[model samples]
Target chain A: EPEVTQTPSHQVTQMGQEVILRCVPISNHLYFYWYRQILGQKVEFLVSFYNNEISEKSEIFDDQFSVERPDGSNFTLKIRSTKLEDSAMYFCASRGDPSTNIREKLFFGSGTQLSVL
Target chain B: LAKTTQPISMDSYEGQEVNITCSHNNIATNDYITWYQQFPSQGPRFIIQGYKTKVTNEVASLFIPADRKSSTLSLPRVSLSDTAVYYCLVGGLIKAAGNKLTFGGGTRVLVKP
Candidate 1:
């Protein structure tokens, strides 16, 4: 089965530095999403994207955060400045057409662990 | 968004049925109850989903009451490999509707030998 793929499984960056987490969602999926889980905490939604634009975002997704679909297959989450609290496992997910009478399940990538020191 | 509550942990024996229940008092009409499982060092995996009543798949079963205020995930003949954290989420399919799924403190099931 085709699955979502993310690059840089582990990323370490200095505090205040900018970082970009890249993901390639399932080839045929249309909707994409980004979520983060601080160590030992529940996963929190960051943002959702469709049609080259942001559909929804959480309070944690502020000016420092941005998402882009620079190409057909690449979906990226960019943090303008990283903080210690930003260190977490970032996951990228995608889902196929929900109108197809299916349950609209999300297929997630292995995840990229971001660490800001 | 509907907030969910579940037990912190559960213990099950191999070959026994395990049920994890979640309470969602504020679930809306359009919201769907969904369950996901996570193992160490991996992303959450979708297990089952339901709008109402009972829904079953090869992996698990979901039972929702008429009030839709609560739901239960049933795992049959659970084994040691079934040990993991299970999360319940309520949300919509609209990507723009702030459909961010809120994962509650999951129920960690430890299936013993």
Candidate 2:
């Protein structure tokens, strides 16, 4: 089975710095999404991208955050200025065709553990 | 996106059937009930999904009533490896650029030997 791939399995940076997390969604998947889970907390949706643009985003996605599918196969999430609260495990996911006739599901990456000190 | 309610935790022993129920009273007609499982430090993986009636896959079984207001995930003869957090998501088939799934607090299952 194809899997979503994320780069920099572990990233550690100082607060107030910028960070760019990269992901390679499964080939032939249509929709892409990013989610984050803080330690000891539930997973939270961050944003969704499709057709090379952002389709929807949660309140957690603010001005400091952005996503782009540069080069068609790579999906990247960038945070302009990192903060302590940004420390979490970021996961990238992709889904196949959403037609109801088929059972569509999201395939997630192992995750990129981001730590801001 | 519809909100989902599920148990916080459950305890089960090996060789026992474990069932986790989730409620989504405000689920829309186009929405589908999906479940995901997450082990420590790993991303959530799809377990099962269903619109109505019962759907069974190699991993687990999803049972949804006629009303589609709630769903249950049943694991047969769970083992210690099955210990993980189970998330119930309700969102799919939306007519838009993308259908974003909403995840609520998952049910943590502990399988003891």
Give the 10-residue window scoring lowest on summed lDDT in candidate 2 chain A. Answer: A96-105
What is candidate 2's TM-score against the reference?
Answer: 0.96
Model 2 in CAPRI terms: which quality? medium
Query: What is the C-alpha lDDT profile of model 2 across B87-110, one tens digit per residue?
Result: 999985755577777778999999
Per-residue C-alpha lDDT of model 1 across residues A16-54, encoded as one tens digit per residue: 999999999999888899999999998888998887888
> Which digits, one per residue and each the tens of the lDDT, describe model 1 over residues B1-113?
88899999999999999999999999988889999999877889999999999999999999999999999999999999999999998886554333556778899999999
True contacts kept of 2: 0.62
Give the whole-model CA lDDT for all candidates, comma-separated: 0.90, 0.91
Every model's DockQ, to 2 decimals? 0.57, 0.69
Model 2, span A62-94: residue lDDT tens: 999999887879999999889999999999999
TM per candidate = 0.94, 0.96
Q: Alpha-carbon error at B52 in model 1, in Å? A: 2.1
